[model samples]
Target: MANLLDQLKSYTTVVSDTGDINSIKKYKPTDATTNPSLIAAAAQMPEYQSIVDDCLLAARKQLGTAATDEQVAAAAFKSLAVAFGKKILEIVPGRVSTEVDARLSFDTEGTLAAARDIIAQYNAAGITNDHVLVKVASTWEGIKAAEILEKEGIHCNLTLLFGLHQAIACAEAKVTLISPFVGRILDWYKKDTGKDYHGAEDPGVESVTEIFYYYKHFGYKTQVMGASFRNTGEITELAGCDLLTIAPKLLEELQTTEGTLPLKLDASKAAAMNIDKIPMDKATFDAMHEKNRMAKDKLQEGIDGFSKALVDLEALLAKRVAELNVAV
Candidate 1:
């Protein structure tokens, strides 16, 4: 009997949701994703110190002595992200998701510029946009930015998505992929009602199921990747999703356990289900998003958390630059 992880992979594309290079080698997911949080965490590990130090040195040399500390630090932060992304790309044959600055979640032009800049950095390193997925928060502006970039041959991964409205918007924008957080949704419901939930009854599972059905029912091409899972059950429940970005811990659990993982989500099954197609225009999107408190709150929280992680990475880089300067 195959492990549950292998069983799940038969039905869905598995994505490693981490910046840890060792874990990526161990799990061997089809694709891998990294945000500020994962990168920041990896930067703190002794094994990854050289990666961060090398990027910091390159960033300092590129900016020269005239650049301010903030400028140098910002340059290094972006460099570190791309540096990690390039390494991940080397390991995964499919695609690697590198996220934009979370602070630009509401700025369409800003997000667009950042996406282009990141893609340019990747290209300079001999990696094309086809191997990269620029991850953006699922704000209206972020969706708009994705829409513009998609037409220009730059692919996007709409992250921190929590609602059907966000999924609909991404589909309408023709974005490359959308990551709907399954565990985070469950966390919100658990905190709100103070009750534990599991399996099919979990709010997170229900949310992804609904979005999966909606996308397939409407014949949308944008991929729906369930993410931020809390348990193996959540991952199993979403077995037949387009993709599943899972953390290392859950991946290990699935790998060690043997079970019959049934396919819970099938596009063909979704297409046959009775589901209504909603027009995802700007007005409708905003209105519907406003009505879903859990989605709205979680989206903002995810952005803020990622922004903080970026800030922490910048501070760490600045400290490293200072230490190197003192040694000189």
Candidate 2:
């Protein structure tokens, strides 16, 4: 009998949700994703030290010897993500998701500039936009920026999404992908309601299921990738999603477990179901965002978390530059 991982991959494209290149190789996901936190985590690994040093050296070279450690770190922070994406792209057959700095989540212009800069780095490395999905938070500004990037032939993956409104907005924007966090949503519900969820009953699983149905039913081209899973149950429950970016641990569990992974979500059934469509724009997005407390809180929290991780990475690089006494 084939393992669950192989079965799941048969119906849904499995994406690795970490920056660890070895894990990507081990699990062999079609696509891989990385955010500031994952990149920071990977940067600390001894195996990845050379990658970090090279990015810092390149940044220092660009800025000249007069650049402070702080300046060098900031520049390297921008390059580090694309650097990791480049490595992951070497392994994954499909596109790799490299995120914009989370601090720019609310700044559409900053996000746009950062995304363009990331894409430019990849381009310089001989990787085109087709091989990458510039990931951004699902803020209205982020979605708007992605909408423009899409028009320019650059693809985007809108992350930290928790509400139907955000999903609708991304679909309307025609962004290439949307990563609805399944585990985080479950965490919020478990904390707020004080009830343990099981399998299909899991709030996180239900959330992504609704999103998968909504996207297929509405004929949205934007792909839904269920991400940040907490358990194998949530994973198996969302068996037939368009994609599911899973953690290495869960991937390992699925790889060893033998079971028939059923196709839980079907596009044809979703298309036939009666699901109301909401008109999405800046105003509607804002209103719906304001109304959905879970989405608003989680979006802000996810941004803050990712922003802090970026800050920590910058500091680590700064310290490295100082320790090495890097000059020119």
Candidate 3:
């Protein structure tokens, strides 16, 4: 019998949900995703230090001698994610999701600018946009920005998505992918209801399943990638999703566990269900956002968390650059 990992892969495209290259290599996921938090964690590793150092030096040179260390650190922040994405692309045979600054979640122009810069950097490195998925928060503004980017041949991954409205908007915009977070949804429900959820009953699992059914029912082309899993059970429950971005530890569990992983989410099954389609314009999106407490709170909280991680990474870059200068 095949292990769960291999069995799961036959049903869904597995994506590594960390910036650690070694973990990605061990699991061999089809794709990899990195957010500010993951990139910050990987920056501390000795093997990845050189990637950070190179970004700092390049930022310094680009800005010239008039630039202060603080300015260089700020400048290097964007490239750090791309640098990590570039490295991840070398390992994964599929796309690598490099996030736009989460601070730009509500700023359409700012998100577009950051996303363009990220893609430009990858292009300069000879990595085509096909191998890169610029990740943006699934705010109304973010979705609109991605809509524009998509027409220009840039693919996007709408993330921090907690509700169906966000998913529908992303699909309507024709973005390449939407990352509906599974574990985070469960986190919110578990805390709010003060109860435990397991197996197919997990709220996170249900959320993705709903979105999957909606998409398949409407015949929307935007792919759904179930992300941010808390356990292997959550992972198994999402089998046959378009994709699942899993952390390394859970990937290890699936790799070692032997079982018949039956397909839990099938497009054919979703298409046959009686799912209602929600119109997802900015007004509708806003109305839904205001109505869904879990989506609103979790979206804001996820942005704040990622922004903090970016701030910490910038501070680390500044300190490392200072030490490098002293050594010279």
- Candidate that would win on lDDT: 3
lDDT of 2 by residue, 1-328 (tens): 9999999988999999999999999999999999889999999999999999998888889999899989988888889988899999989999999999889999999999999998999999999889999999999999999999999999999999999899999999999999999999999998999999998899888888898898898888999999999899999998889999999999999999997889898888986799888888789899998998888899999999998998898899999988767443
Report every candidate's CA lDDT.
0.92, 0.92, 0.93
What overall lDDT, based on C-alpha atoms, would model 1 receive against the true structure?
0.92
Q: Candidate 2: worst 10 consecutive residues by lDDT? A: 319-328
**TM-score for predicted model 1 compared with the true structure:** 0.98
Q: What lDDT score goes with residue 37 in model 2?
A: 91
Clashes of each: 0, 0, 0
Name the candidate, 2 or 3, with the larger lDDT value. Answer: 3
In candidate 2, which residue ranges exceed 4 Å CA deviation?
Answer: 326-328
Question: lDDT, candidate 1, residue 318?
Answer: 85
Provide TM-scores for the models. 0.98, 0.98, 0.98
